[model samples]
Target chain A: MEQILRYRVQNDFSALSRFLEELRGLPGYARLNERQAYRLGLVLEEMISNIIKYGYDDSKVHEIEVVIRWGDMKITVELSDDGHPFDPMRHHCPGSNSAEPLEQRPIGGLGIHLARQMSEEMTYRRENGRNILQIQIGGGVAGD
Target chain B: MEIGFEMKDKMTIVHLQGRLDAETSPAAESQLLPRLSASGGNWLVDLKDLEFISSAGLRVFLMLAKRARECGTKLTLCSLRPGVRNVFEISGFCTIFAIEDSPAGI
Candidate 1:
């Protein structure tokens, strides 16, 4: 059996708050084990915040779509937005500079990296002025 | 997430309570950055109560670390929960911050 939860949100942080509530309350979210749930939440927040912050050139409002599909084997999340076509995966993960010590390491450059690191697989596509991202994670449905 | 600040023996101790992901990081950044700028003293971050963190939170600590280095100040992160520590280790942040097993040693 397959189960899904979908959300349509404005390009505002307030929308994110509501979306998070729904995600947490999703029927089977509790059975996903702690790590997978955390990943889903982290990816959702990171991607949507990027869209809300950089998705538009003007102050006008826009909408973003989030869909989560889960079953016994794996969980998949899809995010689509009507904003500019920016691929989160294109950015490189600059290696942390452990040699120079913590103080010298750069401040930025970890959001997309963590998103990539968390998901087992990810794909991105652009069409008709919309950007879509899909990610797959987890193994068997057994609780941890 | 709640953020508390205290001065302990020349170290500016920034104690984080609760998750430090995207949702809470903005609040954390707004509260912590100003203090970070004014602080050239050593830093001991107490993360015993923090259970989660994402890149957004990582960026905040990194900013402080980089700035402190530029200012020749000291920074240390201590008492991370296993889950939060994994986020840092996964992001390779474990190597980027001076980490200790407990806050008492710092």
Candidate 2:
């Protein structure tokens, strides 16, 4: 089975909520034991939030274009936004392991790291003044 | 996001439900951080019903843990669903925070 969702959502939390609900309502989403589906939601939410929070230079509301392809074996997410040009894949500090002491660790950056770690694969690009991120989760696997 | 504060015996248990993401984390931090500093540093957060947690949510928990250590109080997170637990595992947080099967098991 295959499903695709393409929609433009405002930079708001309600948009994130609405997108999640749509993902949950897919044809075979419920049959797959929501954990994998929830992983999709979490990855999408984190990536989009970063675009909305840091991608824009001004406070003006922008539309983030999201394309989700729900396939039989895996789920692919392609998120594009008209915010600033930044690559979530390359901008953050590299080689920061999760083994740092709690006191020495920074509170931030873990979100993007989690988004990177959970997905089976992820790619980022900057094209035509937009930031694009693609993420893949749940590759022929059920549950955690 | 909904947070309920419960006084269980001598420990303060913070009950969290719904999604703890970028949108709801600031409020969660404001409500959760102050209590950890009030001399009772021993804390238990019940995350059984917390369906989703983003990195923003991790920051709140991390902040609480860092502060609790300075104050010499313990923080135990219990009843985490597998999905939520996976977030902790990947982040290597299992080594930093005390996690148990249930609040009673803690």
Most DockQ-accurate candidate? 2
Which tens-of-lDDT digit does each residue in B1-106 have in candidate 2?
A: 9999888778888899998887789999998888789847378899999988878888888888888988889889999987889888877778888998998886
Clashing pairs in model 2? none
- iRMS per model, in Å, is 2.5, 1.8
DockQ of each: 0.46, 0.66
- Chain A (candidate 1) TM-score to true chain A: 0.87
**Candidate 1 backbone collisions, by pair:** none
Per-residue lDDT tens digits for candidate 2, residues A25-139, read 7666676556666688778877888776788787788899998888778888899888877777776742136667666776677767788878988888889888888888874
In the range B18-92, model 1's lDDT, one tens digit per residue, is: 778767788888787677778878888999998778788888787776767777777898998876786788788
* Residue B99 in model 1: lDDT: 97
Q: Would candidate 2 be rated incorrect, acceptable, medium or high by CAPRI criteria?
A: medium
lDDT of 1 at A87: 89
Candidate 2: count the clashes: 0
TM-scores, one per candidate: 0.83, 0.87
